[model samples]
Target: MSDRQRSDTVHYDGPAGGWGSLRGITRIFGKEWNSPAVLETLARQNKPGGFMCTSCAWTKPANHNPLEFCENGAKATLWELTTRRCTPEFFGKHTVTEMLDWTDYDLEQQGRLTHPLRYDHATDRYVPCSWDEAFAAIGRELKALHPDEAVFYSSGRASLETAYLYALFARLYGTNNLPDSSNMCHETTSVALKKVIGAPVGTCVFDDFSHCDAIFFFGQNTGSNSPRFLHPLQEAVKRGCKIVTFNPVREKGLIAMVNPQSPTEMLTGQETQISCAYLQVKPGGDIAALMGLCKHVLEKDDEAKLEDRSVLDRTFIAEHTTGFAAFEQKVRDTSWDEIEQNSGLTRRALKDAGQVYVEAERTIGIYGMGLTQQVHGFENVAMFVNLLLMKGNIGREGTGISPVRGHSNVQGQRTVGIAEKPELVPLDKLAQMYGFEPPRNKGLNTVDACEGILAGKVKAFIGLGGNFVRAIPEKEAMEEAWRRMRLTVQIATKLNRSHLINGEVAYLLPCLGRSEEDLQASGPQTVTMEDSLSCVHGSIGKRSPASEHLLSELAIVAGMAKATLPPNPNVTWDEWVGDYGKVRDRIEETYPDQFAQFNERMFTPGGFYRGNSARDRVWKTESGKAEFTAPKHLSATGFADAPGRYRLITLRSNDQFNTTVYGYSDRLRGIEGTRNVLLINPDEIKRMGLESGQMVGLETDAEDGRTRRIYGLAVTPFDLPDGAVAGYYPELNVLVPLSHHDVQSKTPASKAVPVRILV
Candidate 1:
C-alpha cells in the first residue's frame, strides 16, 4: 500500500498559507535544502541577482521583503533543485511498464532526468543515448517530412530567450504549428481584449492595486493559486478599499488570507479577511452575473438622469469609445428572470453588488481560469471589458482588466514569439530581418495538433517544455494519438507522465532548471521573463547544475536549429548557442520598436515594463478607438437544470499547480490522500438518496452523441450550487471532451461540462 491508501481522509480547519504552509514546506523540501550549495541557490531566489520563482507569474515588487517567497514557490524551487538523480542506472532498474503504475506525483518525484534517453521497444525501457545521436535522429525525421507534418509545442515555464529561438527555428523549417500552454489558460483574455482594446494583455501593473478605489475578483481564487498575490488584497483592505469576489465555491483564500511569512500572525493563528463581499454563482455563469451587474448599472444610470446625478462616465464614452449604445441596449433588453435563473443570484443581490460598482470612481476586475475555461470564455472576458467601459475604468491608475496567469512567464512566450497563427505581426518585417519567407498558412493549435496526430497527419511532435499530454483534455483520445506518433521529443527537467506514455519513438532530453547556471561561449547568461503585468526582467540562475550532463533550454533550441539546418552560415546557430547575448541582440534587431534597449535595460534592477499602447490610450485597431462588443454568450446555467444531471467544474487543488500535483491533499478544501473525489451539494445528495463518501460514476453530456465515463470516484457532499459539482483535474480530465471548447478562442470548456452521476 502507498501513503495515499494509508491516509483515506483528513480534516483541515485552518486559514490559507499560515502554519499549514510552513508544515507543507518543511515536509517537502526540508531535508535536501539543509545543504550549503542548495541553501546558497535558495538565497538567490527573487533578489537582485536571483531568478524569478518558477511558480506563479505574480510580478516581483520593486522593494520586496527579504523573505520574498511563498510556500508554493518554495515547493516549486526545491522540487526543481532536488539532489535525487534519475540516471541510466535508475532507468535500467525501473522499466517503462513499471513507471505506468506510479501516480503522476510519484512519477515526477522519482527524481530529475540526468541525460538524454531514448525508448527501446525490445527492452521495454528507455536506454541512454548521446545528445548528438538524439539530435541527429530528430533532425533526420523532421527533414524527411513536409513542414506541416511537425508540431512544435511549448510550455509557459520556458523563458523568452528559448521561446524566441524555438519560433525562429520553426518558421525557418517552414511551419507555424506552434501550440503553447497559453491556448488552454488565457487565450480568451488575449483574443477578447485585442478585439475590443487593441491589446491582448492587461493594462494594469502592480502599483494599480495600491491606487485602485475598489477591486472585483470574478471566478478567481487568489489565495490558493497565487498566495503572494494576496498581499495587495490585504493592503487594499487595510486602506478601506472594497474587495469583492464571485465564484462557484466559497474558496478559503477569498474568505480570508494569512501570510505565512509574518511571525506575529503565524504565532497568533490570525488571518485577514480579503473579500468584503463574495457572490457564489453557479458554474459557467460568469457572463450572466456580469450581465446582471451591467443591467442594474444601466437601470441606475437611467434613473440617475431623472435625479440629476452622474452615474455613468459620459465624457469618456463620448471621447474614447464606440458601440456603447448597442451594448447598453442589449443589457437593458435582457430579462431579469433569465439573468436570475442563469446566474443563480437574486435580482436584489445583483443590484446590491452593482451598487458597490456604482459608488466607486475606479474599479479593477481580476479573474483566473474559472472565467476562461468555459464555453463563453471570450464572451466572459468581453463582458468584463464592457462593464469597465461603462464606468471608464481602463487607461487609468487602479482600474483595468487583470487576468492572473498561471505560469511564471506565460505572457512572455507569446509576446516574444510562440503561436499557431503567424500573422499576429508583420510578416514582411520578419522576412526582411531574418532573411526567410515565413509560412503564411495556418497550423495546428493545442486541439488541432491532437486531431492531426490521431489522423496520422502529424509525424513528429517536439515539446520545448511542459507535460503536453497531461495538461490537455480528452485523455483517452490524446493517449492513443500520442502513441501513434512516429517521433516524440520532450525537453524537460523532471520526469512527467508525458515521458512515460511513449510514442513509437520517444526521447527525453533533460535540461537545466531555473536555478541552475547556464554557461555558454559568451560566459554565463541571464534569461529574461515577462510577468502577468508585462514587466520584462532578467532571470539569472545562481546555482550549479544538478548533473553535469544537463543542457540549458537556449542550448537545446540552438542545437535543434543547427541539426535541422546545416550549412546555414548566416543563421549563426553555432555562434549564438555559445553566447546567448547574440540571441537577445537578434531579438532586439527583430522587434526593435518594443525591445530597443533590451540587453542594457534588463540588467537594471526590476527591469522595465514592455509598454502596452492601450495603457497610453492609443488604440491600434482599425477604428483607432476603443470598441464595445455585444457578446453572444448568455447564461449556461440551464444546461445543468435537467434531471439527474450536474455541471462538472474541473479545478486545481491548493496543493497543486496546473498538472503538477505537489501533494494528494487540498488543505483549503478539507481533502486528503487522494485526487479521486468529488465535491457535491449535500442537499442534492439527500434528495437522490445518496450518502456522502459513496462511490459514483460520471458520463459527459456531450453534443457528439458519445458517452465518456469515469467510474469509481469517491463523492463528498458539501456546500455547492444545486446543479454544480467540483473535481480536481488531470485525474477527472476524461469527462472533458476535446471537441467541447470555446468557439471564439478555442479554449477547453472544462468548467461547463454537463455530466450525469450514477448513484
Candidate 2:
C-alpha cells in the first residue's frame, strides 16, 4: 500500500459516530440545519409501532430504543419537519431562472413548499395556484395526450400506499411508463436476484446480522449510507465474525465504527473494528473478486474430495441447486492472471478471504450501488449469489444474499407495483381489481424515460416524489429533455432542481411530509412502507403539518385521478383517499398472497415479514430449484486497455442522501465545504504530471461520436487503486452517457466510466 496521503488534516481520524457524530447531529438539528422542532418530532421516529425514518430504508432491529434514529436519519427528519417555508412570497422574491443558479443544498434550504405553484411564462416565476385548478389543468393536458406519451416517475420515499395509488392512476389513465428511482439504483439487484432466487428482494432479514459467522460486504459502506447497520456490524465484530469487505474506495464505515447508540462505548470512547479484511478492488471489478473467491473455494473443495473429506455442501447442492458443474468449471477455466489484474488483489489475498468463507458455516453476502451501477451490474450481483450458493449458504439462518438498498422503500415500491416491466406487477390482477385492462407493454426505466423525453416521444411527465432530473445521469440531456414535456407535475415537500427544470406547463404541488400529520375525510390516517428486509409496517405522522394548505400524497394522487379519470365505479380514487385503510384493503385484494391480512398486520408488532420462498429453500423458479448463472464477464473493463484513462466511479458524499444534499461538507472522506473536488490515487496524479490540488478537466471515453466532459474539477490525492478515481455524483453525471447502462435492467452505469484527466 502507498504511504498515507494527507489532505492537511482534512481526513477525519476518529471512529465513526463518536463525539463527532453527536456534534454533527447537533449541528444539523440545532442552528446549523436550523430545525428546532426536530428533536420533539424525532421522539416519534423509528419508535416501536411508530413512524419509520424518512432516510435510508434499512430494516430496524427488533426492540428498538426510543431514540433509534441515526444521525443522518435525524437530518432527514429535520429536513422534512423543519419550520422553514417556501410559500408564494418566497417564489415572488426569486425568479425560476434565479433559483436555478442556487446549489441543490441552498435550493432545499429555502425550505418546505407550502402551496401549489404553476409556471408562469409571462413573469418567468412560479405563481401560487389553487390545488384544484392546478390538478384540473394537469388533468386536461394528460387526458389530451396519448397514454404512451405520458411518463409517471416515482420516488423511493413515497409510502407504499401512495405508490400503489400512483401506479393505479397511471394504468387507469392508460400508461405503463412507470419509471422510478429504483430504476436508477437497484434495478440490477432486482433483475439478477429474481432470475436466481425466484424472489427479487433480499432473502435474509435483520436477524441474520445477529447470527452470521461470516459476512461479505461487496461495495457497500455501512457507516455513511446505512448508519443503522453499524450497530449490527459492531455486534458481529464482538461475536468474532469475519467481515470481509471488497470495495474500490476505503470507506471509513467499513474500517471502524463506534455505535452512538451504545452508552458504554460512547462513555469509554471505544470503537469496534468492522472488517477483518478489506480488499480494495478496482472500480467495476466486483465480479472478478467474487469469481476469485469462487475459484479458490472450488480448489479447496476439490482437495477435500480427494482426501475423502468434504468442504462444499454437496448434499444441499445436489438437493436444492442445479448448474453447479458448469459454474465450477467456469471458475476453474478463468485464469488467475486475469482475475488478479482485474480485481486489483493478489491470488493469496483472495484465497485468504475465501478461507474465511469456507470456515464459516453461516455466511451472508451483501452489496450496494458500488456493484449495481456498473455495466455488468446485474452479473455483479449474480456472481456474489453464485459464490454463496456453492456452500448452500442461503435458505438457512444467518446466510443469504442481501442488497443494501440505497433508498428507503425502494424495494417496497416494487413489491406494491411500481415496476417498469409490466410482468413484475400483476397486470391481470390490477385490471380485475380496478376494472381496467392495465397497459401490457413494458414501460421505461430511468434511462429509457430520458431517451423518450429527448426524442420528444414523451409529452407529459408526472413524478410522484423525486428530483428525477438530478438523480439520473446525463444531466445536460435530462435538463433539455425536461423542458420538452408539454406538462410536468411534481408532488413534493420541498423544491429541487427538477421543479425549476420544467416543461411548458409545470406545477409543484405541496404535500404532507413523513414527519407531519395527515387528516382526511375519515379522520387521522397512517401510511405504510416496506423496509429493505421486506417488513411492511405503518408510518403515522403526528407532528403538525408544515402548512395548512398541504395535502397528503394520497389525497393529491386521488385528486389527480378524480380529475383525469372518467368516473369509474369499480375503483373510486376519491373514496379511497378519504380513508387510507381502503387503500390497504385494495392492496390486500390485488396482492392477497403477499399482503395477507394487510390491515390486521399493520397493528401487529414488528409488522409482518413478507416471507420469501427462496429463503425457505422453496424455489418458485420453473426448474423448482435454485439455478446458478454465470456472469457475462469477470470484469466490466480489462487492464492494459484504455490507456491514460482512469476508471471513474461516481459516489455520494457522507453529507447527502440520494440526491438530497444535507450539507456541503462530507466528513466521511474528509471533503469539506465543496462537492466540486475529485479524489484520485496519488500514483495517477503523479503519472499525469498533475499537482495534488491541480484543477483538471474530465472527458468521457465513449464509442458514440459525442464529447461529454465536466471541466475545472479540483483533484486530490487519496487512498485508491492506481488508474482509478472517485468523484461525487450529479456533478460528474454528464460523464455517464444515456446509452451506457446495464442492458437487461437499463440502469445507468454511473459507477463505471472511463475518463481522461486534463490539467
Candidate 3:
C-alpha cells in the first residue's frame, strides 16, 4: 500500500473480530450479552412474551429464533441494560455544572438514573426529589402556563399506551404542542404519502420481501441503520430478485451481505451479493433520479403498447387517481439534460433502472433518511409513490413503497394518536370516549416546538423519551431555549444532554426501560408497539427495574396528568395508571376497528397486521386513488451545486444509533476510537493540497457570519463520490443550519450541507 493509503486508513485496536463476531461469542459465554440493552430487549421481543425492541420501527415475525437480534440492536440493548447507575448520591457528589462538562457518552455511561432529580440553580446541582414532589412541581409549572405555552414531546421509543395517554393529557390541558421524533425523521413521508395515497405509513410488510421480484433501494444503508433488514435483502437476492441500490456512498449491505445465521456463508467467509445494479447519485438528487426513472417508464410503456398493461392498473388509476394527465405531461416535458444535471446520473443509467422495474412482476422501493432529509423531501416521497402508482405496485403482495423508519415505536406512537394535530375521526372519538371536550387546535411539531421555546412562547417542555435538546439541529440554540424554559421534564431511562440542559425547574424522572418489568396493580404489564410494516405487537419487560422508584412511562404520564388536569367525571386516570390493560381498552374505544382486540391480540404471536390500503390496490387519496405528482421545477441546492465546496453528509456509525454513541467503532469503514474525522475522496484530498491525518476546519456558507467549525478532524479519504464528504451525525449536526430544512417536512437537511474544507 502507498504511504497515502496507510495514512488515510483507520486502524482498530480494541479487540479481535468485528462488532458482530464479538457479540456472537459473548452471547454464548454470557459476556454481558456484549450487545446494547435494546438488542437484548429485541431478543426477548415478541407478541406478548417480552419487551418491545427499542431500536428501529421495523417489525418482525414473533416466531423468529432466539438470535434474531442484530449488531446495532445489541448495542441498543446493552446501552440500556448496563450495570452502571446514576443514583441520587452520585448526583450529590457531582453538580449539574460539573456533569455539563462531561461528554455525551460519559453522561449516559454513568448508567440508569435511580431517582428523579431537580436542578437546583442556586447550588448549580441536580438534587433528588421524591415522586410526589416531582409530580407536584411539574403540575404546578404546567398548570401555571397557558396550554399553548407548553410543548409535549414524545420519542419513538414511547409505547402505544403511554403515547395515547400523553395525547389525551395534552388535549385535556388544551395544548397541541405535540412535537415528536417523527417530525424529525419521517414527517416528509407522512406528508407526501398522505397527499398522494391518503396514508402516511408504508404500504408493504416484511412478508412482501419474499414475493418481490425486484427491490429498488434508494438513499438507505440497511446494514448499519436498519440491520434487521439485512436478512430480507439477502433473502430477496437469494430468491433471484434483482436489487438495485441508489446511494452516494456504497454501503456494504447493498453490495454483499454475510448472514450471521447462515452456517455455510459464515464458515467460508462467503457473502451474498445483494444489488444487481448500483447507481451513485449526488446528495439531494433523489427527485431528479426518480423523475428520470418515471420518464423512462412512460416512454418505454408507450413504445411497447404497454401503456394500459396489467402492470399499470389502469382501472384503479381511472377510478381513484387525479392529476394524471398533467403529471404525465410534466414528465414528458422534462429535458434529459436537466435530469442528468440535477440527478448527476446519465440517461442510460436512469433508463436501465426503469427497465428493471418494467420487466419485474413485483418491485419494492425502500427509502430512508436520504430521501426525506432534503429540501424537497416530501416531493421526493411523492415521486416514489407516483412511480409505484404508474406501475400499479401499490396494494400488492411484493410491490409498494417502504420507508424504513427510525426509532422502535415511532410509527406505533403515531398510530396511537401522538400527533400535534389529531385527525377528525380520532379527535371526535377521543372526546366522546373520554366525555370531555378535547382541544381541536393543531399542535406544534418538533421544529415549531423548538422555535416556540426559543421565543419564550413555550414555558414548559415535557419529553416522554428522547434526548430532544441534543438530537435537534442548532444545538446551541436548542439548549439555550431549553435553559430558558420555566420547567422541563424528561421521562427517560438513562441520562442525556437534554436533562443536563437544566430548565428553571428541570426534572429528570427515571422511567422503567423496555427490559425492566412493569408490575402494575393488575399484574405485569406489557406495552404495545406498531412497527413500520404496520404490525402491532406486545412488549413485556423481563428484567428487574434499575430502581424500585423507577416508574413505567405510562404511570409517570398518568401521575402528571392527574395532578395537572381539571376534575373530570368521564374517565378514570387512576384506574388506567394502575393497570395498562385499561389504557388498551381506551385505545380500542378510540379506534374501534384498528385496536378492537388489543388485549386479546397480544397473546397471538406477532400480534396483528393493521389495515394496509396498498395490499388491496386501494389508493386512499381524496379522489380515492393514488395520484402522480410531478415536480414543479428541477433545482439542486446544498453542496452538490456549490462549486469548490464539498457536500458533507452526516451518518451514524455502526456502533451508534441516533445520538447515543456505543463507542467510536465503524467496522465496515475500519474506523475506531473516534468520530472526529471526515471521510473524503482521495483525489479530492490531493487536489485540495491536503494530507491524511491532518486536522482541518469545515466552514458552512452562511450570510449570518456564524461559522460552524470542528477541530482535530482527521481527513480519511475513501471511496466517497467526488466533491463529497461524510462524517458522523450529531457531532456534525452543528454544521446543519436550522434554516436548511425540508420546506414541507421541516426536517433538517442533514444529509446535504454545503461546506468548504480548510486546513
Candidate 4:
C-alpha cells in the first residue's frame, strides 16, 4: 500500500451530515454512474410509486420528498446500478483460489454478476453454465439429502414476495431450516418482545417522532447504520423532543447533525443538537444500566406516594400488565454498588436518565445490535421492555420499544415465514394452503446450521440473497466446512466472498437488484417490502437490469422449486413467475390477517402498516397481558469475571453497509485508507503501556479450547469508555466463538467479545 493510503486517523470535529456528506455522495455518484439518467431512478427511492431504499430499514415519510435517500443509501443504490459487470470472461480469467486473497471491497468492486456460474473442480474456476443445467444439478443434490440436512438461508434484501415463495418452496421440500439475516441481528428482539410484550415488531411509525416527548437511544448508532433516521431526529429536536443517548462511544450523528437536504442550514452550516444528554456506557453494560433506571423509578414512585403523587402508571399497570410485583422485587433486591460496577455508570447518572423517563409523557426506546448482539441479549431486550412497562410507555401513540433493525427487509423476511423456529409462523395454515404437511420439528438457525455443517450433518446450503459466509460468525471454520457440502447455491446481484467459498457443486445465480426493472411475462412487476416500522410498501424498478442474463429473485426461486420438486397440482411455479400478483394472492391466502387485500394495499400511497397488537394493549400471550421478566445477572455479557480483558464491539463504518465494505476509509471516524485498525480508549492505551498507531494482536478470551486470534492490527486512540475497544465487523468476527451467543436468540455476541491485546 502507498503511504498516502496507509492506515491513519484524521481528526474530525464537525457534525455528521453537512458539507462532508455532500462531498462523500458526489465522490460515490461520480465513480458509479456514467450518465445523469440514473438520478431519475435515485429520486424514486423510498418515495411513493418507487423502489425502497436498499440500504437500511428506516421508514419513508407519509408525505413525499424529492430526494429521500441519505449518503449510505445512495451508495447502496449506486453500487447496485453501477455500469461495471463481472461477466463470464472476468470469472474465466480469475480462479477462486487467486481471488481469495482479495479484499471484500475489491471483490464487490469487480461489479455485478451477469451470468450463472458453476465451480469446476478440475479448472478450480467458475465457468458459465445455463440456468436450467445449474438448477438440475442443485435439485439432484438437494434430493439426495435428508430434508433436515438442507439449510435454506435468505438475506434481508429480498422483497416480501420473494421471501414468501422461498419459504413455501423450502417447506414443500420437507424442511423448515430457513435461517435468515435476522438470526444474526434482531432475533433477540423478536424472541424477547414476543415473550414479554406479546409482539415482536416495533410499534412506532414516522409520525410517532412528532408526538414523542422524548426518545431514549440505547447502543444504536443512527449515523452509520441508518443515516436517514437523522432527519426525524433533527425534526424531533427542533420540536422540543428530548433525545438522550446511551452508548460506549459518543457517536457524532447522535450528538448533533445538520440535515443536508435543508437549503438554509446547508448554506449557513447550521447544525441541530440531537441528544440532550449523552451517556458513555460500557460495552455489554446495558442490562445493568436498565436495572439501575428501573430501581430509580421504583424509588421515585415510593417518594411520590408519600405526597399523594404517582410517578408510575398505576392504573395502566393494574389493567394491562402482569408480573409487575416480581419485576419490582427483583429491582429492589439489586444494590447500587452492583449496578454501578456492572454498568460502569454512577448511580446519579442512572437516576438522571430515570428521571427523564419518569417525567416524559410519551417516550420511545430505540436500540440496535449493540444491545441485541450480546451473550444475555434476551435479558437486555427484556429489561428495556420492563423499563417501558413501568411507565406504560408501550401501547400508546408515541411511546414503545423500537429496536432499530439493520438491512432493508430483515423484519419483513421473518414476517413472510423465513424463520427457523417452527412455532413462530403459521404451519397449519401453510399446510392447508399448500396441500402438504409442513415440518413441525424445530429447524436449524444460522449458528446451528453452521454447526451442522462442521459436524458433517448438513449436506446442502442455499441462500436467496446476502453474503452469508462473510456476514456470519465463526467464518473461518464455516469456510472450511462449506467445501464439504454437496451443494451450495447463492442468488445474488454482485460477486462476493461467499461465491468464492464454494462447495463441490456450487452455483452462483445472478438476480435483479431492487432498483432494476423486473419485466415478467405479464408485464413490469412490483415487489413489496415491510420496513422497520412494519409498514408494507411496493417497490417497482424503473432502470433496466445490469445484464440480460440476470433474472429476478422471484424467477430464480420459482425455477429452483420447479426443477427440484415433482409436478405438484398445488404449486403453480410458472404462473407465479409469469405474474407476481399470483404470489401476492397466495401470500394473502397464507397470512390473511397480516396480508388482507395485499394487492390493493400495494397501490396505497406510502403503503400500509401491519398493525402491532401491543400498541393497542392487546396481549397475544397465554396470560392475555403484557409481562415483565427478571434477569439473573446485571451484565448483558457474561464476562464480568474476566477483568482486564477488553470488550470488543464489531461496528460498521460510515462508508459501509452491513458487511459490504464500500471503501477503505471510515469518514465518520476520521480514519483513512484502512479497516483493520482498532479504536480503543486513550486511557486504556496508556494503562497498558501501548502507544497510538502501535501494531498489536487480539486473541479471544472465550477459552473454548480453541485458538482464535488476529494479528497486525493498528491501535488508534478513541474517546470511548475504558475497558471497551471497537473494531470493524467480520474482521473481528473470528475472535467471537460460535458458542458465545444468547441461548434464547442464538445471535452471535459480536458486540461483547472478550479479548486480550498482545504487544
Instruction: List the candidates ranked by TM-score, beginning with the highest.
Output: 4, 2, 1, 3
Task: Highest lDDT: give the candidate number.
Answer: 4
Q: What is candidate 4's CA lDDT for residue 49?
A: 85
lDDT, ranked from best to worst: 4, 2, 1, 3
**Candidate 3 at 227: error in angstroms?**
1.1
The Cα error of candidate 4 at residue 214, in Å, is 1.0
Please list the residue runs of candidate 2 whose C-alpha ends up more than 4 Å from where it truly belongs after superposition. Answer: 1-10, 32-37, 637-640
How accurate locally, in lDDT, is each candidate? 0.82, 0.84, 0.79, 0.87
Q: Model 1 clash pairs? A: 521-578
lDDT of 2: 0.84
Q: Residues 1-759, candidate 4, lDDT per residue (tens digit)?
A: 001111233346778899888888888888897577579878888887888889999888768667889889989998998999999999889999999999889999998899998999999999999999988888888888898999999989998989999999999999989999999999899988999888988878778888899899999999888988998888888988888888887777887788888899989989898887888888899999999999999999999999999999999999998999988999999999999998988998889888888889999999998899999999999999999988899978888899898899999989989998899889998877878899999999999998999998998999988888998888788899999888999998888889889888999999999888899999999999988998888999988888999899999998888888888888999899999999999889888888899999985676698888998889998799999888887888877656668889998888889888888767777888888888887778889998988999998887678888898889998777778888888788888888989868999988888999988
TM-score of each: 0.96, 0.97, 0.94, 0.98
* Cα lDDT, model 4, residue 63: 82
lDDT of 4: 0.87
Candidate 1 residue-wise lDDT, 120-198, digit = tens = 9889899999989988888888898899999999998988888888988998899999988989888888788898899
Among residues 3 or more apart in sequence or in different chains, the pairs in candidate 4 whose N, CA or C atoms overlap within 3 Å are: none
